[model samples]
Target: MTDFAVSYFGGRVSLRFAKGVPFAIAALVIAVIVVGITSLLAGSYDLAVWDIPALLSGQGDKTALTVLWDLRMPRFVAACLVGGLLAVSGALLQGATRNPLADPSLVGVSQGASFAVVSLIVLWPNVSIWARPIAAFAGGVCAAMLIQWLSAGKRGENSLRFILVGIGVAAIISAGTSALLTYGQINRASSALGWMAGSVHTASWGPCAVLAICAALCLPALIWVVRPLTALRFGSELAIGFGLPVGRAKFGVITLAVAMAAFAVAAAGPIGFVGLLAPQMAQRLTRAGVGAHLILSALGGAVLVSAADLLGRTIAAPIQFPAGLVSAVVGVPIFVLLILKRANSSQL
Candidate 1:
């Protein structure tokens, strides 16, 4: 799996693979470049790939420029921001909870966001679209706060216990969302389901503007959380011993993570597993601990989500799946492999 090129048919139809160290190093660079270019170039139109230079110089055709500037640009920017948001939230959650499986969605963040959106659609169907992100952000952070409280001081932390609690909370909220939609007076279930699945199909400058503003407001707070995050890894005692304001810091981080998840969900309907996969992959690739460079993890996240989105759109063509679906289908196996690897190593 380490080898880059595999030859067959007299080396005429060679295949290639990348994994482990070589994969991490080479893939990081290639992923950054490929994701950036492909993300910019992809869309409904047929632009000349070689004509990228003209577009960069603002000399491309009007239609091509429209595609690049209007349609593709916002979506591409969203992919990067939403992706980074989810990944950072994931890394922070994992570090805070000292759980490899911790993610924004797991602590009911996604469910909370979904609930707020679904309620908006059902109770106030005529409400303007501009307000959905606001509601979702409010609900998601509240849920995170609640979950953090519940999980606090729980020792050796049974991962399954956390998962079960999360699932239960999520299930209840999901049922509430469904109930709101199913009510004859307000059957907005379809909208709820769609949002739950995650899609950026309706992405535009509006949500993009909101996302950017939130990122600017939230990134500094997130960075502050990172320092405490490192202290948190050796358990809350050491964190408090280091004079880190453990409880307040954890609350702040969970709140920000919730907001990030909510913003992403509002913009792209709860894109699953980006949070779960990105930091884990970064760790595996760099052999770094949870407290490693936040910037690298963020970039890794952006590349992953961007590439997955590209794959989602291109693989099926006219009837492409959403990027979120693409991640679940692709990410589940990798998640399993990580679990199996951990289990095997533990027994040995």
Candidate 2:
């Protein structure tokens, strides 16, 4: 379907959108808001739905205020931020590589961050918790750089080569992480396992602030990549024919994607499948341009993670499952379905 275009500044500025894009975006926004509110209200602590307004206004009881603000709010915010970041990262990766199967985890970013954080937990148990995010970001960047270096050749970067190298690097990193968990101090390893499970149960204001800052920093990069991402969907050769610096554009997009994924992993461990799932879901929901698709993906991701976290928290009462586990349980079947569909189409 062709897009509807709107012009402003005597056509100097224009925006184009697919027919269903607005509705899809609205639905996703509503879903996120609903899930967030539900998450804030539904937890181990009994919070009446009506009490939310009072709590928000600071007119509620001290304990209620503490529960709402100190405990639930941070977790809610972290889940949304992590989900949105991962989804956007995934969208960027899929566009840059022109591969529907592309994801932050598939590309080694999540594994790198996970390895760094796990290493800290297992080997440097006494280190300050504040350092984990730094370690994660550094590790993720290093891994991405390695992937780029390995993938680049005399002919320039190949998307297939990038994916293959990322897979091999991710495997090696995963093995190293597993070894740390296997041989490191038992108690520390256990703690690391909890983190690796990707729970936001311990989310606090500091990490929330850090995540927000990372998201803010990424905004400009996201905008800058929109045109390049659109061009890249047609392949590097075609993008170059259109006068785009395909190599630099891919590098920039991948770098931006890595930064978003690493920050999310740093904030909330490695939440799997979100980066893979959200963009696909958004695309299926609406035939939109890259920018609209990204907005929809971010909102969809926020809803998915927030709802998963809420279910994990309330489903079994005091015993809470990690958000990442819940997401995997939901995502794995859908992922398989997508693969089957793709395979069938290829055969057709």
Task: Give the runs in model 2 whose Cα sits over 4 Å from its true position.
Answer: 7-13, 126-130, 147-165, 343-348
TM-score of each: 0.83, 0.91
Candidate 2 lDDT over residue span 238-285, tens digit each: 898999998889889988988899899988888888988999999999
lDDT of 1 by residue, 1-348 (tens): 443566888987654434344446556767777776887777669776788788878996898988887777677677877888888888777776776776766668888898898888777879888788799889888777666556544354555456456767777787787778677253466666666677665577877888789788887787577578878878878888999988887777777778778888877887777888888878867554333445556777788777877887888787767888888887778767765665654421
The prediction achieving the highest TM-score against the true structure is 2
Model 1 lDDT-worst window of ten: 14-23
* Colliding residue pairs in candidate 1: 198-269
Q: Which residue runs does candidate 1 get wrong by more than 4 Å?
A: 1-30, 149-156, 184-188, 287-292, 337-348
What is every candidate's alpha-carbon RMSD to the true fold? 9.5, 2.7
What local distance difference test score does each model get?
0.73, 0.87
Question: lDDT score, residue 260, model 2?
Answer: 93
Judged by whole-model lDDT over C-alpha atoms, candidate 2 comes out at 0.87
